[model samples]
Target: MNINFNSEDAGQIVIGAFALSVPIAFSEESWHLAQTLPLGNMALVVLLSLGFIALFAYQSVFQANVMRRIGVFWLRVAIAYLLTLAVVSVVLIALDKWPMLHQPILALKRTLLIAMPASMGAIIVDSFDKE
Candidate 1:
C-alpha cells in the first residue's frame, strides 16, 4: 500500500490514543504499577511498544515497500508513538499523576506504561481503510 502521512492521519492517531488512554490513565492499578515497577520492566514496555508499531507499520502500511519510502515509514511510527505519548502525558498531568518536578522517573514510568496501549490504538487507527 502507498501510505501518505497526512493531517487526517494525525487526527486519527490522536483520537485513537485518547480512546485507549483515558481508561488506563484513570486506573489505580496503573498508577501503582508505575510507582513500583522497575526500570528494566519499563524498558521492556518501550521495546514492546516500538516492536508492535514497527510490525504493524510494515504489515499494514509499508507492506514490504519500506525501502522506497523509508522516511514516511519512520515518520508514521514516530508520529503515532509520540502523539500517543503526548496525549497520555496530558491526561496524567491533568490528573496530577505526573509529578515531573519531584519524581520524574515515576512520572516517566507512568507515561510509558500508558503509552503502550495508547500507541497501539494510534497505530491501529492509522491502518484503517487501507486494503
Candidate 2:
C-alpha cells in the first residue's frame, strides 16, 4: 500500500507521532513490549541519536537538491542555509519543546526529543526540495 508520508499533512504526522511516542515511551505501559517507547528523559538519548542520523541523512539529501538548484551561487547557498536554520531552529525546534533539548544532553530520550524533530523537519524540507 502507498503511504502519503510526504504530503502537507506530513508535519501533522510527525507531530502526532511525537505526541504519541512521548507518553507511551516513558510510561510503564511500554514495558509490556520493549524496554523503551521513545520518550521520557532516558529515552530522549535514543531520540537524539536517531535525530542525528536523521539530520545527516536530511542534510546529505538536501545539499544534493540545493546544489542542483544553485550550486555556483553563494547567495542561494546563504539563503538556503539561513532558511534551513530558520525552519529547523525557529519553526519546529523553537516552537514547542526546545526547552527539552536545551536541557543537558546527559540522557538518551531527551536528546531524541530535540534531535528527532530536527531531523524530521529537515527530512521534510529535503523531500520538498526540487528533484
Candidate 3:
C-alpha cells in the first residue's frame, strides 16, 4: 500500500479540504470559538486533528502495510492536515474572517479548529479514489 504523493493526489486533497472548510470559515461560531477557546484547548484541537488524519490515512491510504511504509503514511497525513489548514486560511482571508494582522494566534486557532473537519473531508475524499 505505497500511495504515491503525486500532483493529482495533491489536487484532490486541496479540493476536498476546501469543499468542507469554506462554509465553516464563514460561520460566526467558528470565529467566536477561535477568539474565546483557551490556548490549551486550541492546542488540543490541533493535536486531535492530526491524530484523526493519521488514523484515516492509515485505514484508507496505507491499509495493511502502514508500518512498512510509515514514511509515506505520515507524509500523506501531514499533507492532508496542512492542505486543510491552507485552504481554510485562504477562505477565511477571502471572506475577511481572518484577523491575522490584529490577532495572529486567534487567526491560526480559527483555521486549526475548522481544519479538523476539513481534514476529515480531505481524507475521505482521497479514500474515494481507492474504491
Candidate 4:
C-alpha cells in the first residue's frame, strides 16, 4: 500500500518522540546556556527538534529513493554522513567550538548518536496507519 507521507505530520511525530530526552537535553543545554541566554530550555528543545527532523527528513528521502542493494544502502548512508558532517562542521565553526574528531572512533560515535534518533523517528512515522 502506498502511503502519502506528509512532511508536516512527520515533523510532529519527531517532536512527540522527543519525550524521554527532553529532561536530559533540557538540563544539559540549560546548564550550557545559563552562561548565555534567556529561554534556554525552550531554545534547546526547539533546536534539538529541528535538528532531529532535518536528519530524519534527509535519511527518509535517501532511504526511500536509493537502490535497495546492501552496497548501495551503505553508499547512501555514507553520503548522508558526509553531508551531516559538513553541515555540523560549519555550525560548530560558526559557534567557535572545534574539537578533534579526526579519528574514525570519535567520528563514527558522533554520527551514530545523531543518526539513531532520526532513524527511529522516521521508522515511527512511516509505520503509523493513516486510514
Candidate 5:
C-alpha cells in the first residue's frame, strides 16, 4: 500500500508525457477544440482523462491490493496527471500555442485534451519497471 516517488519514475513519466503530448498539443484540431468546446464538455473531458489515468494506473502500476493502496495510488495518479499538464503547458508555450493569459479556461481545456493521451503513456511507462 506504500509507494515512493522516485526520480527514475518521475523521469519516465516526464519523458512519456512529453513524447505523447507534444504532437497532440501542436495539432490544429486540438487547439480548435479547446477554443470551441463548451465549458461543460471540456470539464467532462478532464474528468474522463483523470478516470482513464486512474484505471490505467490500477491495471498497471498497482495491480495488487489496489483498494488498500488508495492513498498511494491516487498520489501516483495525481502526479502523472500533473506532470502531463506541465509538459503540455510548456510545449504549448514553447510553440506559441498557449492561450492568452486572460483566457485561462481555454488553456486549461487545451492542456487537458493533450494530457489525456500523455497520461496514458505515462501510466504505461510507469509499469515498465514494476518489481
Candidate 6:
C-alpha cells in the first residue's frame, strides 16, 4: 500500500487527538498520577505509547509492508505521535496544568501520560481513510 500523508491526514490526527485528550487532560487522577509516578515509569509510558502506535500502524495502516515504504511508515508514526503530543500539551497548558517553567519534568510526564491515549486515537483515525 502506498501511503500519501497530506494536510488532511494532519487535520484528522489533530481532531482525533483532541477528541480523546480533553477528558484525560481534565482528569484529577491523571494529574495526581503524573506528579506521583516516578520518572522511570514515565519513560516506560513513552516507550509503550510509541510501541503501540508502531504496531497498530504496521498492522492496520501500513499492512506490514514496511520494507516497501519505510519512510511513509515512519512519517505517519512521527506525525501521529508529535501531533498528539502537541494537542495534549495545548490542553494542559490551557488548564494551567503544564508548569513548564516551574517544573518541566512534571509537565512532560503529564503530557506523556495523556498522549498515550490521544496518539492511539490519532492512529485509529488516520487508518479510517485508508484503502
Candidate 6, 1-131: lDDT as tens digits = 44788998899899989999999999999999999999899999999999999999999888887897888898889989999999999999999999999999899999999999999998889888777
Q: Estimate each model's TM-score.
A: 0.93, 0.26, 0.94, 0.32, 0.91, 0.95
User: What stretches of model 3 exceed 4 Å from their correct place?
Assistant: none
| Model 2 per-residue lDDT at 113 | 38
By lDDT, who's the top model here? 6
The true-structure Cα RMSD of candidate 1 reads: 1.3
Per-residue accuracy of model 4 over 1-131 as CA lDDT, tens digit each? 22333555445344433432233233434334433344454455435645554445345544344344446445433443344344333333344332345544333333233333433443345444433
Residue-level error in angstroms, candidate 2, position 110? 2.9
Worst 10 residues of 4 by lDDT: 19-28
Model 2 lDDT tens row, 22-42:
443354333222324433644
Q: Which residue ranges in model 5 land beyond 4 Å of their true spot?
A: none
Pairwise lDDT winner, candidates 1 and 6: 6
Better of 3 and 6 by TM-score: 6
lDDT of 2 at 112: 38
lDDT of 5 by residue, 1-131 (tens): 22577998889889999889888987999999888989888778879889988887787777756776689889998998898889889999998888759788888888888888988888788778875
Q: Count the backbone clashes (under 3 Å) in each candidate.
A: 0, 12, 0, 0, 0, 0
Tens-digit per-residue lDDT, 43-71, candidate 1: 99999999999899888877767887889
Q: Candidates' lDDT values, in order?
A: 0.91, 0.38, 0.85, 0.40, 0.84, 0.92
Q: What is the TM-score of candidate 6?
A: 0.95
Rank order (by TM-score, best first) = 6, 3, 1, 5, 4, 2
**Global CA lDDT computed for model 5:** 0.84
Candidate 5, TM-score vs. the true structure? 0.91
Worst 10 residues of 6 by lDDT: 1-10
RMSD of 4: 11.5
Evaluate residue 13 in candidate 2 and report its C-alpha lDDT on the 0 to 100 scale.
31
